[model samples]
Target chain A: DAGVTQSPTHLIKTRGQQVTLRCSPKSGHDTVSWYQQALGQGPQFIFQYYEEEERQRGNFPDRFSGHQFPNYSSELNVNALLLGDSALYLCASSPVGGADEKLFFGSGTQLSVL
Target chain B: AQSVTQPDIHITVSEGASLELRCNYSYGATPYLFWYVQSPGQGLQLLLKYFSGDTLVQGIKGFEAEFKRSQSSFNLRKPSVHWSDAAEYFCAVAPDISGGYNKLIFGAGTRLAVHP
Candidate 1:
């Protein structure tokens, strides 16, 4: 089965613009989580979606939001982006909602805010 | 607050040499821990994870990590390294399912360089 997959492998946007990244969870997985990884930094949790509702969110601001579809696909939307938003945004999927569940990650969308 | 810390910013070792990467975490309860590796321009891959049962957990890529609750550590180790192992390694932690969401707290990450 295919692992978690993300769309638009790379993206470029201007400061103050908006951008959207998409993700499809791994086969047989229902929970999707989004992460942002800055240069030389580890992935930071952005939020999580389960059952078509956002179950949890990180310390990020309202400008960052996400939605999970009934099919387990997800989308991350960032508004009024800043140059600091340039980074790799990753999507991870797990089979279960438990804390001990193993996560499978997608290659990620490299967003470059100019 | 749950948090993860990887003390090493970068490490360089000769191929075939033993390697170790340090990790530390702070959580209210017994935390779930994980080690992931990311190659250049690639996404993170799970190396291994620790829950309750074993103190030592073996992972893919010939990697392993030992969980030490007393020290709040889960350091990743490999007996011998290969040049292809050059990548960035991250340590992460999460609260028990009872806490909900399974959101992860990740460290800054350690970049490993294997020199032939």
Candidate 2:
């Protein structure tokens, strides 16, 4: 069984540019959540998407957004990226049932904002 | 709001020495606790979790964690360290409420360095 998959394992961007990171949920999972891990820090929650709708979000600004497709894949879009936005974007997938605690994380996208 | 705290920013241990990473949490009730380790340029991998029933949970890599309700602590431990054990370890928690989805709040992390 395939675990969670993410695209663009590494990326480079500039300030004022936008970037979209993709994640394919683990097999048999339907919910996807995005996180940002800055250098020397832990991962911070970005938002969660279920049924293609954002169910919850973190303290991040509106510039950070995400979407979940019917296939349970997800996309995290950052608008007008800032240098501080440069971080490892992590994607975690879990089933939509009551067991949200058991999550499988994908190898994150290391985003570098130059 | 739920939060996790990993007090030790970094630690060094000998290859054959025992290891322990401290973690504490703040929550109204017993929350879902977890320990994850990450290698360089890799995503966080779940080591162990405490949902209910057992306070001591065993996980991969011979890692184990004991949840102490009174102390609000979930500390990870291992009998011996391997060179490959050198990585960043994180503690996380989520509200145990059954109705909706809860996000895992992670600590600042503790970087473990193993020496030969």
Candidate 3:
């Protein structure tokens, strides 16, 4: 009955550096999605992964990539991070077969780019 | 392209007073709508959602939302407000097409401040 969980609650990196954030989906969930929430703004969709493959993506650039493991866990990697990338990286999970099902979210990893 | 809009950037109300947050969306067809609340330094928690049926949907914390297709709006309402209700509320919509993988487009958000 565990909810979605994310690692490295906070991270700090310099421009041009890369970082990887991790997320574990909720119990009995098979789909995982990532989002970026800027200060004073809502979360923006990054991408979604299901069955170890990316199913859908948002308007983000290719620098923002993700992977889904067999256990339904997920990782978001950003290459050549820019100062604008500093934000709260959120992870959300939902069960498959239900398109409009509610999503469970993790506290999110706060990324700070210098 | 689907998008959500929360008109109110911030609102303040008495603890015992009623509350409502306005939300509008732009989409070609009916989209899955949702309302989420996020406390300071926390994640967004789903309050309620409208998928296919029932224009009026009930959610936790006595929060409810009404979906109006004509207006392309989904507004969240609560009969009374609590001090703990002070938080940021977000409105989101997701496409329901076959390729939909629960990718949601969110509004900027409405920050609620409750006074004693």
Candidate 4:
């Protein structure tokens, strides 16, 4: 089966601009989560979406938001991007009940905010 | 708050030698632990996980991890290292929350280098 897939493998945005990254979860998975991996750092949780609703969010600001579709696909939107927003945006997915412990990840979209 | 810490920022080992990467976590109750490996330009791949049961867990790779509750640590080990095993390793922990959705707290990660 195909693993989780993310769109726009790489993206470039300017400060104060907005960007949206897309993700399609692995086959037979329902929940999707987003993470940010900065240079020389591990991935940090951004938020999670389940059943077309946002279930949990991390310490991120309001500028970071996400949506889950019926097909289990997800989109991560960042508004008013800052230079620090430049990082690898990773999309992970898991089954309904095992949303936390059993996760599969996508290659991730490299966001470069200029 | 739950958190994970990987002590080594970088480690270099010769091919065919044994390898060990240290990981420590802080949590109130029993925590779920995991080890993930990431290659350049690739997503993080799950190596193994520890929820309950056996303290010694074997992963897809020639990798294994020992969970020590007493030390609050879970260290990854491999009997022999391969050049292709050179990559970044991450340790993560998840809180035993009521809801099914729990965010993972990841360590800064350890970079492994293998010398042939």
* Most lDDT-accurate candidate: 3
Chain A TM-scores, one per candidate?
A: 0.95, 0.96, 0.96, 0.96
lDDT of 4 by residue, A1-114 (tens): 899999999999999999999999989889899999999998999998989999888889999998888899999999999999999999999986774458899999999998
* lDDT tens digits by residue: candidate 4, B1-116: 78899999999999999999999999977788899999998999999999889999999889999999999999999999999999999999877456543488899999999999
Write candidate 3's Cα lDDT for B11-93 as tens digits. Answer: 99999999999999999898889999999878889999888898999999999999999999999999999999999999999
Give DockQ: model 3. 0.78
Grade the docking of candidate 1: medium
Model 1 clash tally, residue pairs: 0
Candidate 2: docking tier: medium
Candidate 3 per-residue C-alpha lDDT over A81-104 given as tens digits, one digit per residue, 9 for 90 to 100? 999999999999998676447889
Candidate DockQ scores, in order: 0.70, 0.62, 0.78, 0.72
- Candidate 3 lDDT score at position B100: 60
TM, every model: 0.95, 0.95, 0.97, 0.97
Segments of candidate 1 deviating more than 4 angstroms: A96-100, B99-101
Q: Candidate 2: lDDT of A13?
A: 96
Model 4: per-residue Cα lDDT at residue B75: 100
Q: Could you give the candidate ranking by lDDT, starting with the highest?
A: 3, 4, 1, 2
Candidate chain B TM-scores, in order: 0.94, 0.94, 0.96, 0.95
What is the per-residue lDDT of model 1 for residues B46-102, given as tens digits with 9 covering 90 to 100?
899887898999999999999998999999999999999999999988764554435
lDDT of 1 by residue, A50-91 (tens): 999998888899999999888999999999999999999999
